[model samples]
Target: MGNVQLSLALSGYDHTRDLVEGRVATPGIDLVAIQLSIEEIFYRVAKFRDFDVAEFSFAKYVAMKDQDVNDITAIPVFPSRAFRQSSIYIRAGSPLRSPEDLREKRVGVPEWAQTASVWTRSWLHHEVGVRIQEIDWVQAGVSSPGRQEKVPLKIPVGVNYSSAPDRSLTEMLLDGTLDAVLSAHPPEPFKRGTGEIVQLFGDGGREEEAAYYQTTGLYPLMHVVTIKQDVLDAHPWVAGNLLAAFDRSKQNSLDRLADLNASRFPVPWLRDHLKDVERLFGGDPFPYGVEANRATVGKFLQFSYEQGVAARQLEVDDLFAPQTLSAYTL
Candidate 1:
């Protein structure tokens, strides 16, 4: 047959130069634009979680893991505050001070959120000894179809609020309608979006306030990629090419970020944030070249299994396109 057309998808923040180059077996190749929202792609891919598919994360690949997948690179990194630096927001002048004060109180959250809401709930219920079931959950933006179907786990007795959740959450918090709001960062509605609200505490409980509730450990917010093995088997060249191309692009992007930042994407918070993106690329600029792929895959697979997502333990080799690695040696 003629050259195969492979499809790839990523978040808006991600740079795609490497991905496109990695997949190009020759100067010219077939095309299949599979562009979609990251959430939409993830939701679609999650449907096939039951299948025995092979997958690799460009982020994990570039970070220098032990194993090899196919071509993938320039993986995206979000604002750290959106993931690690999470917090609970209450009225500025309210008596509800810490996570402990939120017990049995109504809490507002972005409706049907997968990672942020799920992590927050799991942290509160499992780690903090808080009976999250007892608290009232106001799911904001329930009417938005995109947001509605994205629920990771069921909301235990949450009220599906349809109005603009940002406004609702802020109003509720201020008017005492909501006892708390669990969000990656404080809601922006209060300040008219100029500045974000400050976090109450760091990842765990406050060092000084020993009485407050906290988490047992830091949880991963997002990092999973899956691809079908059938496609790779059909087109052996695609996988390796994609991986190598992505590695080069990630390296180039990292090195030239300062130059690219001013014109392409200007933001003080985002500047130099991707210095660690190379960590995933490992020693070489190609995916699966070094042992970094194996290390990352092993770690995340174990994490996924522990999180009760995967049914059984999958060996590192079981998830990657092995043929792709041989091509990388050249």
Candidate 2:
């Protein structure tokens, strides 16, 4: 039988580079990789089901699943994972001193149901004793003037979320209109090293590392690879094939990063940094499959339900294609 051809939309990350470059092949499928920004990929896939397979937001995916939008099903391949402690930004000289200080303050976010924002909110509510209803939430782009929530959200009662289509989060934060901004992408002013805005966790790297060690044992997930349900129905083998290929691609990337003889990245002390990461997250930090990520997935589902992004609490098994949930041993 001829190989099935499929279109895949994903970000240009090192882990996915092998799949994009044809170094790793899906068993009997011909993949057409279309690299795009995370926002574009998520928006297109969530709204239009544009690609046969795509990297999608975990929060949005759960929200869709909760709403019974089952056009797409996911594999256990997570393309993006991050610790979101650093995502929280506060203006300089603000009265707010800690995560607990966010109570009753205006906080802007790129989207109400963004994966990064979800994790950040979870950290605040769970670790810092700040409830969602206590913060006045604003939704807007981090850099640009207008950005809208792509998915419908059943916002919890007493959660004041407003849209500022005319203003960016950066502008609002700088002008004291917003006390904080929770976003995956740092606001433009913050990225430029302007003293106007700073991360709420002053020593973000150290704080994030400590938070990971103290709370959840793994870094929080941001995106997962999803296959169109129709594609899986027509080609049941595609699920296993895609999962295997993604696993191989990620291993290849990890191998490159762990090569100490030659520096894979241009950053100074990359080898040492890699050692630190390995020490913290183990040899295979970014693991795939439901069994490997159960804790993180379970916590995220709990957060989504609590935050009203997911109408009902979901299990990890329910989120992934059944065939991709487990693999047979040789």
Candidate 3:
């Protein structure tokens, strides 16, 4: 029989290029990989389930799962993960020097259920002692107007939250309507290098972010690869096949990054940074599988419920497909 043809969609990333380009092939499947902006992929999947497999926001995935929406099941192939401390932005010389100073201050988020904002709020609530309810939370587009939350939220009582669909978060922060902004993407003024806005921490919050990693051992998972439940139900082995292929694709990128012999990436000091990352993050900075990411997975769910991103608290075992959770013994 011919290989099962599966349509897959995800953002363009170095790790996923191998799979998209057919350098890494799913054992029993042929992937018609479609590369789109992460937002576009999410919109299609949420509204239409447009592809058989696609990248999903970890926050949205769990939110739907917690509500018993099982049309799609995620595998352990995390395509996007990043330290979110650098995502917090404030006007230059703001009085809010620390996260604790955010108490009672207005903070803008692109969306309440945004994966990056979820992680950033976790840090603020858990690490900085600023309970989420203490701050005034405003939702809007980061760079454009009218961005809206992808999922419904069961927000807690006493939490000050509102929406500004006509104005962007970047504009509010610049115009002083908001004290700060938390975003996965940098604000327009920051990108423009106009000196009007700056990250809450200097140098992408590297010193503090490294400290956060050391203390929490959390790299902050932002995205996951998901397949339709019906697809998985029909071909159980497809889960393992796709997982293995994604793992290989990621490793290919890692190999290229670590190979300083050629300029595989245009990043300056790439060789020096590779050595440093290897030393700090070990060989697999981006490890796949549920067992490898248990802490991060569990932690995200804990706060996902606390913050109302998840309708209910989710168990660690409840998320990924069972086939990808374990493998046959050697």
Better of 2 and 3 by TM-score: 3
RMSD list, candidates in order: 8.7, 1.5, 1.3
lDDT of 2 at 242: 88
lDDT by residue for model 2 (17-122), tens: 9988899977789998899998899889977899999999998999999999999999999999888888889888887777888998999999989999998899
Give model 3's clash tally.
Answer: 0
Which ranking of candidates, highest TM-score first? 3, 2, 1
Q: Which candidate is the best by lDDT?
A: 3
lDDT of 3 by residue, 1-330 (tens): 989999999898999899999999788898998889998998888889999999989999999998898999999989999888899999998887877788999999998998999999999998878999999999999889988888889998889899999999988998899999999989988999999999988777988788888888889999999999999999989999999999999889988987868889988898888788878787688999999999899999999999999877799888999998787787
Q: List the residue pairs that clash in candidate 3.
A: none
Worst 10 residues of 3 by lDDT: 274-283
Provide the overall lDDT of each model, using Cα atoms, as 2-decimal numbers.
Answer: 0.45, 0.89, 0.91
TM-scores, all models, native as reference: 0.53, 0.96, 0.97
Please, what are the lDDT tens digits per residue for candidate 1 over residues 34-153?
Answer: 555544555555443322222222223322232232333222221111233245666656666566666777777654333455455555655566655656777553112123423133
Model 3, 35: alpha-carbon shift in Å?
1.0
The Cα error of candidate 3 at residue 181, in Å, is 0.5
